[model samples]
Target chain A: MSIDPGMLLAIAMMSAVTYFTRLAGFLLASRLSLRGRARAAIDAIPPAVLFALIAPVVLTHGWPETLAAAAAGIAALRLPLLGVIAIGIAAVVILRALF
Target chain B: MTVQSEYQSSTADEIRQGLADIAPVLVAMVPIGLLFGAICTTKGWAASDVWLMSTLVFSGGAEFAAIGLWKWPIPYLALFVSTALVSARHILMGVSLAPKMHAFKGWRLWAAAWFMTDEAWALGERRARRQTITVAYWFFMAVPVHLVWVASTVTGSMVGPMLGDPAAIGLDFAFTALFIGLIAGFWKGATTAWVLVASGGASALVALTIGEPWNVLAGAAAGIVAAWFTATEPDEPESSSPEGHLL
Candidate 1:
């Protein structure tokens, strides 16, 4: 597995762009000085982002995935993180098998 | 209790909790990291490249996108754009996360930003919701995830395990499950319910239509808009509303 200059360039570009993305939001937010509805919008980010992330997996994958996601999601309300993971994996596996 | 002593004790507690908090995610990452490295190895990419990308680029989704886009001639612009697009969510994540890390001073805040993966950011936000996010907590939560990701990727390049379908074992659902739990922590009754339904539905619709990265932005924007319209304003510091106390 020898190194290639071309590959190195690609890696550098990816790294530079990614680091910038990570920092840009913080820098941008620092200057904004938001309040009220804007602050509420920001506070809502965690859940909003989370749901956006898993939506395709849960909603579009299939019935098994959707149902399994619900099982795991409901488990989340009552279980610890590890327990929720167990339930989700188990539910998906079983549902996939049944369907 | 003196302020200094309280800070010291809480720092220690946060450190331990931070490690504990990230433990399950680290476990979930193992198969993913291994699979990533194995794919690179099978694709005939150099070990150094695998390790470097994992260490430097340090984003699983972007790195995976790069692998998909890899070729002999190397589509440089396509590669760069895809990497940027796949990782663009970090911008939104950082926007939300920056305001909460009040205790992170100066360079520490910037430094911490390096490890703000989806899992790390979600866990950090969870921590912030319950109490102040201490430096020790953030570092301990984020740093180990980075190290483990790098280590696992390198190992996978070497071993190149023939991991069968991850979906078959339900390994793919691990992140979804973990996120489900994390998202549940943000529950605030109907307001949050509306925010999630809008975000998830829009995100899913976009993923089915326009696809990747755009879906994230579209959905998040929708959720934020829902938040603005539906949420009771947490405008005052000592207000009785649940949001007022937290936000």
Candidate 2:
């Protein structure tokens, strides 16, 4: 594929912004000691952020896909990490093919 | 002890420790990285580009998002905005590491920032809560994950397309199962569970209406706000705790 200047620029910007976000805490936490409500807010941030990241992917694909994925996940939960992953892949592919 | 001696000993120890600590997560990351490499290759990125992303960006979610958004012809500003929004958790990771990292300087801080992934952050928080800020400890926690991440991408770039349909061999399941496993591991209490459910519900609701990237942002915002409000207390004393606990 031909590389577009715009795409490269976007990728560069995305990289910069991502780096900035990652470094923000390191920069800010030391300078501004969080206390009281701010501390509470900080503590809650991670779970919220993580949930935000994971939830959409499951939902956007719809219930059938999500449910299939979840089922695969559930089955894999007790197995080794590799085992679980295998199950999930099989479920997605097989279900897709079946329907 | 001499400064050089101390530095050498610490670095050696850290590399050893970092590998050990990250072993379990690395196992999971390998497959995911491979999947990412494969997907990127399939999407037409060069092998070098795949490795470059893993080396530089080092963020699974953001990298994936970047690839997904590439087709949009979105402006760099929008891409950056989206990435920042997605990676907002890194800010939280940095905040939690503050007290432990008070003494780090210059390149050390920057290196830490660059390697501060979800797994690394989780491990670092656990170590920090115990008040262990040894450079070795952090290094031990970061390096292996980073190496595996880079290597896996390279592997995926080469092997992913060759594998053809990842679903054919069931490799595709690794992503969803791993995430589900993580959710199970992380859902400690009622509040956390609700936060996830609410976030999922909100994202789904928004997605059904708005679609595409907006769903990701809207869902994330809803979750963050919900968790912020429903949180039990501030100064809850770092979730990592000092007991080597896995919360």
Q: Best by TM-score, which number?
A: 1
Give all candidates' CA lDDT scores: 0.84, 0.65
Q: What's the DockQ of model 2? A: 0.43
Write candidate 2's Cα lDDT for A36-93 as tens digits: 4455445444555545555555666655467666775586447644555556666766
Model 2 CAPRI quality: acceptable
Where's the lowest-lDDT run of ten residues in candidate 2 chain B? B1-10
Error of 1 at B122 (Å): 1.0
What tens digits encode model 2's per-residue C-alpha lDDT throughout B1-247?
0112113345576667666666667766776788888888767777777776777777888888777766554556656766876677677667766655754787788877877887777666544544555677787778777889989988888888775665465454455555555445444466666667776787677667865445555655566566666666554644443322221
Residue-by-residue lDDT tens digits, candidate 1, B10-43? 6678889999999999988887888889889767
Residue-wise C-alpha lDDT for candidate 1, range A1-99, written one tens digit per residue? 667889889999999999899988877764454567777778778899889988999999998889999999899989989999999999999999999
Q: How well does candidate 2 match the true structure, expressed as C-alpha RMSD?
A: 5.9
| Ten residues in sequence with the least summed lDDT for candidate 2 chain A | A36-45
Q: Which stretches of candidate 2 lie over 4 Å from their true place?
A: A1-12, A31-37, A60-99, B1-17, B69-82, B126-133, B183-188, B212-220, B233-247
Query: Against the true structure, what is each candidate's TM-score?
Result: 0.92, 0.72
